[model samples]
Target: MKKLIESLLRQALSALPVSRVPPDARPAEVDVERTRDAAHGDFASNLAMRLAKTTRQNPRALAEALIDALPGHPAVAKTEVAGAGFINFFLKDTAYYDEVARILADSGQYGRSDQGGGRSVLLEFVSANPTGPLHVGHGRHAAYGATLGNLLEAVGYRVTREYYVNDAGRQMEILAVSTWLRYLERCGETLEFPANGYRGDYIATIAGQLHEAVGGELRRAAAEVFSGLPADEPRGGDKDAYIDALIARARALIGTDAFRRVLSVALDDILRDIQQDLGEFGVRFDRWFSERSLEDDGSVDRALAALEKAGHAYRRDGALWFKSSAFGDEKDRVMVRDNGVKTYFASDIAYIFNKLARGFDHLLYVWGADHHGYIARLRAGLVALGGPAGCFEVRLVQFVSLYRGGEKAQMSTRSGEFVTLRDLRREVGNDAARLFYVMRSNDQHLDFDLELATSRSNENPVFYIQYAHARVASVMRQMQGRGLEHDGRQGLARLGLLVEPQEVALMKRLSQYPETVEQAALQRAPHLLVHYLRDLANDFHTNYSAHQLLVDDPALRDARLTLSLAAQTVIRNGLGILGVSAPESM
Candidate 1:
């Protein structure tokens, strides 16, 4: 419908006299938008006002001339100039009737479009380190990224959802050492767990699995493992240095091969756990891009070489530094330290290079709010490596606070006290969790109220939208119970019988689905879709309450039934994109 109005406006512009609308004054693109109020019209365009400055004419006079030159169309019942030369288009009822029929015909494909022009997009998200279970915060990233990928795909973008596994970092080594310490405890050896170690109970679970695999063969005496080790933070020592020393001692005591096996076991187990958690949450990645693979495949060296050749890299104080400050970063970043270890930033740039090499037109990163500072350096690195600056983008998701009843729920991943995504799903179910996670904008903090989400009332947006769908199904079943069969062809043929104010309003809202989806996808905002579904469901519920869907008149009954089915289809499609199910019954 928006496209139709734009086309008509373009025709009107071309029909105008060359003196009134010169070639240079004419707009290359017409901007048609839905009117906020019913009194204004179905759609409105400010083309006349936009051209007024260039043409040196009064906007109202230009609008009148454009309306006079506007070509006639059956779908547009009338066009009127409103405040400040706004051309409002009042669409005919037949137009909305046709839209309802189109909705029925398209079914699941109704709200999608090819607006993206088939551009390739690489979406990297929730690449949480595999050292612990995914807490509630990671759940947001998973849901947001997954739904955003769905939205992008719906709009015809070739999207590749990816998870960058931080498997090559020091965190994994700490996890291995943590597991080994627990293994020694299983062998009746006493040791003080490092403050920096991953102390999650899942670590002990992994330790038990390690024990089952290798028994006490890898165990060393607690004294030997902790001998000559620096005091931990609890004893006024740097926890980082202490953990590194502990890791070295473990390797020396158990041999490098044994240490590697332990690290592999912990990494594989935790990563599998993460994969399962996300899979169950309806979030699946096309690839789990390994950080270790970047180094293994020599991509890091290549990226560094690109930076060096571009004259964006230089050595300073025995460290290889990228001149990120040259590209607007606050300070230069070290890609490799004096100790000859590549920083995580090095792997990050390598990952960006990999994405570019894979031929993605755009690289979208979904990162936690804490990673906001890293975005500048990463983008600077991308530019330094000769990638287009506009091709890289980052979305920061704010923190999520879980609330049970009225009290804020505390969470800590290191201490294993956090609420896992699985736990949230099991308690509130996936439908509610998925909806609640994206109910607010990504940049806004989410206070996930446990009690409100599980409720089966209007207060819960998921249940309300789903109930609207279920109500339509109930109407269909009730019609069948009364020995009245719905003829879709008959319903579509008699759509003119839908004359009630509620019916017209519902149809108008239904027609906005495609536009709503397109706007949501273009803005990269899933919350807009959530709000639209709520509005759509509200319209459906209002019409259902005000009118009789299963009436005695067969034509009117079937017409309303068709409308109900169309509403159900749209509701289902929207929920599906959000990874929430649309139930047929409450």
Candidate 2:
């Protein structure tokens, strides 16, 4: 209805000669908003008011002119210029009913269109460090990213979901140190732990697994590990302390340099655990790209060189700095320290290049909200590297607060108290978890209420939408059990009989599904689908509570069943795009 109205308005405007009113500078948007009062008409738009200033006339007068120019169309039965130049169009009574036929005709393909024009987009998200298990924040990101990718694909953007692993940073080094230290503890080596390191039982589990795999085969320890000096200072606070202790032990038994080899055993364990833990969360990335690969392949160095040559970089404090303020940043950033170690921002620069080189038309970074400041730096880096600034984009998601037992769920990986993605999924089930995570917008804070998500009642979206589908299936089954027959062809032919106001209302809601998908995909908003599905289910439930689908009245039965089937198809499609299942039975 909105598109038809907008198309009509555009056509009407195009017919006016520029000589008459001098073409309106402001473009018009035909928004078909549902009327709060039936007396106002069905879908209302402010096309005339929007055009008033451009046409140099009073809004009411412009509205009257727009109405006069409206062509006769079957879909729009009447157009009235209401108060303040609002153009409200009453959809034809038959048009509402015909949508039911269209629904049955299109079936599952009802809400999908090829609007992407073959553009390819890359979505990178949930790239949690391998130092520990994925926590609740990453869980929200995984759900949002996967659904966004799915939504884009539905609307025809060639999409790739990626996870760029930062496996070569200080964090990874800390993880390695922590694991080796835990190995020393298992081997009865006495060493002080670091003030800051990864804790949690998984570290020990990885250490034990590594020890079992390579117990006596690898020898030496003590001073050899601690040979790196800071032996006088506390090594670390968590698992890294344990690793530093083991390195000290290695240095004691062998030498300073050989202590580095001890990290291999720890790194292997961390990698294995990280893979298994996230794999359980249903977040499989097309790439687990290593930050190390960028440096190893000279990509990071090359990126720095390009930025330096472009005057986007400068040497300061014996370190390389990026002049990000030229593009828009609070201040310059360090690309490399005097010690020759590249900054994480430098890695991001290389990583983006890698993504673009793979042929993605656009690169999307889904980062936690804490990294909001990094946005300007990344954008500036892309420009400094001689790449178009439009190539890279970032979406910072606000924190998700998980509540259970009416108290805040405090999460810290170092204490092993954080809620792992696996734990959240196991408790709430994947469907509910995914739904809850995306229930709110990305920029808004989310309180993932555990009790609400676990409920199997209609108040719960997981069950509510599923129930609509199952109820429809139940009706279809009743028809089949009664030995009645129908298919899309018969359903479309008999849909005109579905004339009840409730039936027409339900069908009208179904007709809006395509636009909902298009808008949601365009805005990269999956919550819109959640809202649409809930509303669609409300319509279904209302119709179910008031009407009968399998009556002795064949004509009415056929019409109702067709409408029900159409609802089922759309509900399933919407749910499918969110990686959710619409069950035929609860």
Best by TM-score: 1
Query: What is the per-residue lDDT of model 1 for residues 286-339, given as tens digits with 9 covering 90 to 100?
Result: 999999999999999999998999899999899999999999899999999999
**For model 1, how big is the CA root-mean-square deviation?**
1.2
Q: Which portions of model 1 miss their true places by more than 4 Å? A: none
Expressed as tens digits, the lDDT of each residue in 181-241 for candidate 2 is 7777777776555656667787778778767876854443644555555433343334444
Question: Cα deviation in Å at residue 452, candidate 1?
Answer: 0.8
In order, candidate lDDTs are 0.92, 0.78
Kindly report which residue stretches of model 2 are placed more than 4 angstroms away from their true locations once superposed: 24-32, 217-280
Range of the 10 consecutive residues with the lowest summed lDDT in candidate 1 = 18-27
Query: Once model 2 is optimally superposed onto the true structure by TM-score, how far is the C-alpha of residue 550 displaced, in angstroms?
Result: 0.9
lDDT of 2 at 245: 55
Candidate 1 lDDT (Cα, 0 to 1): 0.92
Residue 534 lDDT in candidate 2: 96
